[model samples]
Target chain A: MRAFLSSMVTPRALALSALALSFFFMMTLGGPFYYLAAFVITSVFSLLDMVGGQDNSDNDGKPWYYANIQAYQIPFAMLWFGLIYAWYLGTGMSDLFGVGGFLKTHTGFDMFAIRARTTAPELITGGYCLATIWAGFGTTIGHELTHRTWSKVAIITGRWMLALTSDASFSIEHVYGHHLTLGTPADPATARRGESVYHFIPRSTFGQIISAWHIETGRLARKGQSIWSLHNRMFTGWAMTLAYAGVFYMAAGWKGVIIFFAISWFGKCYLEAINYIEHYGIVRVAGTQVEPRHSWNCNQRVSSWLLFNLPRHSHHHAMGDKPYWELNCYPDAPMMPHGYLTMIYIALIPPLFRKIMHPRVLDWDRRYAVPAEYPLIVEANRRSNTADFINNVAPAE
Target chain B: MFSKIFGSATKPATVTILPADISFIVEPKKTVLLSALDQNIKYPHYCRVGSCGTCKSKLISGQVRELTDKSYTLSNEDIQAGYILACQSVPKTDLVLEVPKLRVE
Candidate 1:
């Protein structure tokens, strides 16, 4: 009974509850103010950084409930999408083809009345809530599922979730390109030393799409398929994005399309903000094996619990196939001074972020970087235009 | 250890490295690259996903179940030559493979 009960409340399982809470919060509140309430829920988790502290526990044995944990999120995510858009459309059950009038006749709960109550400020707050929840929940699950190369269902579902954020190509570039090139100059996702989050966000965002395009085109060329064909994942991803926008357009007309783009654009930026945090100012030689030291590891309990142990990034990069539940803690890896949400909040302020992170970067260079990487580290520092690489180096003729 | 000595019902497939003749047992449903890594075999690998072709090897004999499409990373010529990504390949039967390079590290 103890084992069974423990499995019911594991961190991974508990993480799914946030999605449920957000879904219910929006559904019950029935207007734009629900988004404000949802946003407050997300903010409360940010305080977990200080309150929850660190979790260094190991997930050595797999429980029976493990297989269904990730798969279950798909339904919640899909339903959340339907529910939020229904509220925005003010049609409720009407969008469900014939069921709309049938339900409206039976329940007499008019969604048209609720839509009248939604103010512009409330809608703007809804956009913020949509972006944050989608960024935090949708992308985290998407990242996990896309890595399940063994399951085609997982890949498709994960890609669709990412498509909502205008980053379906993450499945390709992240797995095929960024994972292989991480912490090197070739990795666009890696935030270079002295580069602010504002600078990193756009560069990483565009760089990833361009990188995914090259990978997809090269793959298609090898298979003797045209770039325009259905086999082209890049085009297919864009099609999925369009299909989602079409759904919005049909429901709420031009206002819906505008809101959809707003949600997607901000969600993409939030996703890039995560990328900015993971490997900021870290460097590794191009050919060397990716070790635990390459990423900024955060084991803060609340972040780990909410993000599905994504905060344990050192283990994720070291073993790409390992599930989030099984990601081990590496105490020696470079530590993030704050939890994931705190870092994202801090990263938004460029000057403050630099002041906090530059010292840590220098410490990493001194303690972790090997002799072979000195030249690269020195060159990176020079290019960053912040501090000089103060460590002594044996000059070669 | 007991499972190895007694031999489990779902028998693990044995992979014999070509020329070098180093043999290792891959547990059922485990990928070749990961099983080899578990035994501390220096099977040259960078990205364990089917993304990098670093773990590409010639399948001299035996069948394997590929987790992802090898054509994404492996060249057409390499695919035609029965080259598989060890990182993505799970051994189905006892196997022999020609690994191009084994890292000394």
Candidate 2:
């Protein structure tokens, strides 16, 4: 029974199952209490699995590289689950139990006063509903197929999931642009030194998308194909996003459209936060043009398992085609102190993040400094220091 | 009679001199660093292709044959200072090398 359950509960499969179960329980239980409990339970377990490292041997041939890639949804899903739980417990229960009677008779607070002061229930519901769709459907499946290891089946499934959140373009840009140019300045996803998460997120997200389109169009042109043609992934992704808006309009009117866009923007932001944490302050050697030292590795046991060993980043860069399951923990790779989710929260506070990460970054810089490899940058810094020294000198004879 | 004949005929082969403090039991054809790693001593290495100089180590006292990948990551000054890539060097004789201690998370 344990083995059977384990086989069935792959990271992607588990997320999808939990989403379905939560949705069904929400409708069937007909009360906010049961719905909140179920969502909370599912979310907690998902969080655990993400943090608790997985045995790579269990993955077999399934490609671990994509594992961490898709695991972004775990935290996103958890955050959404928490919101839904709060709303269901707070508002939905009140509505179901007769808001006026429950408040006045049970607690003696004026129900009318509370209702007038708070935001409308519909907005909260709509926002959470969209969050659920983006986290479970878009991030989970989109992330998996973006790897595209097994077959076209995997890729197609992943893209459709991303389409739900109107971020299908990520599938193309991530594989073509980010993966190829990772750790280099050419890759917009590669954050520079001294850039904060606030600065990096928008730049990386928009830049990567535009870069992906250019890359794909350039490739197609080389092959005598046109960008106007339907064969392009970028066009397909956009069409799917538009279709999502149309679906939203038909399903829930103008509010649904507003809710959908809001959810997508939030989801994209969440994804960028993960990216910011993953490669923070790490850059490839300028002259050697190597990718290994370019990205920082985070192997905190919980984050590694949750992110599909993504925190084992240096290994991934060293062997891009190597499946995630086979990704080894190289002793030499620079490491992050915390997992992606924890780091994301830390990144919001610039001073706190700098305090924690600056020491580690400086240590890595000094320990791994190769004077020959980056002579120009080092020399320039040295010359500037010398100039400072001369200016500070008290009229040296 | 047999013991006397065999013993007098051959002087015992002399053992090669090795560094007193920094002793490395290197594989005959492999570099000192590679030998250390194969023997379960974790050595720092990035871009094993020698593009990154993360694995640079000093040759304290020994001879080594360099592979083609060595020249680029190492500067002319590094060669004078006895720096070599453990991945690229083949130990020609017994050697003592300074391995940098790096913290790997």
* Steric collisions counted per model: 1, 5
True contacts kept of each: 0.69, 0.05
Candidate 1: interface RMSD equals: 1.0
Q: Which tens-of-lDDT digit does each residue in A1-397 have in candidate 2? A: 6655565567655655565566544522323334364344335534654565533232244444344444444434533343333333343224322534564688785534443444555445535544544553446446654564324655666676676556677776665456655655677887655667898888988897888777667556544567788878788887876766565555445665666677667767767777787676554544343455656776555555445566677776665444556667665667666655467668889778877876665555556545543442333223333332223222121
Question: In candidate 2, which residue pairs clash?
Answer: A50-A306, A64-A324, A64-A325, A65-A324, A68-A307
Q: Give the top-scoring candidate (lDDT).
A: 1
How accurate locally is residue A14 in candidate 2, as Cα lDDT from 0 to 100? 67
Q: Which stretches of candidate 1 lie above 4 Å from their native place?
A: A10-19, A38-42, A60-64, A90-110, A388-397, B1-10, B103-105
Model 2 chain A, poorest ten-residue lDDT window?
A388-397
How does the DockQ of candidate 2 come out? 0.03
The deviation in Å at residue A140 for candidate 1 is: 0.9
Q: What is the interface RMSD of each candidate, in Å?
A: 1.0, 12.3
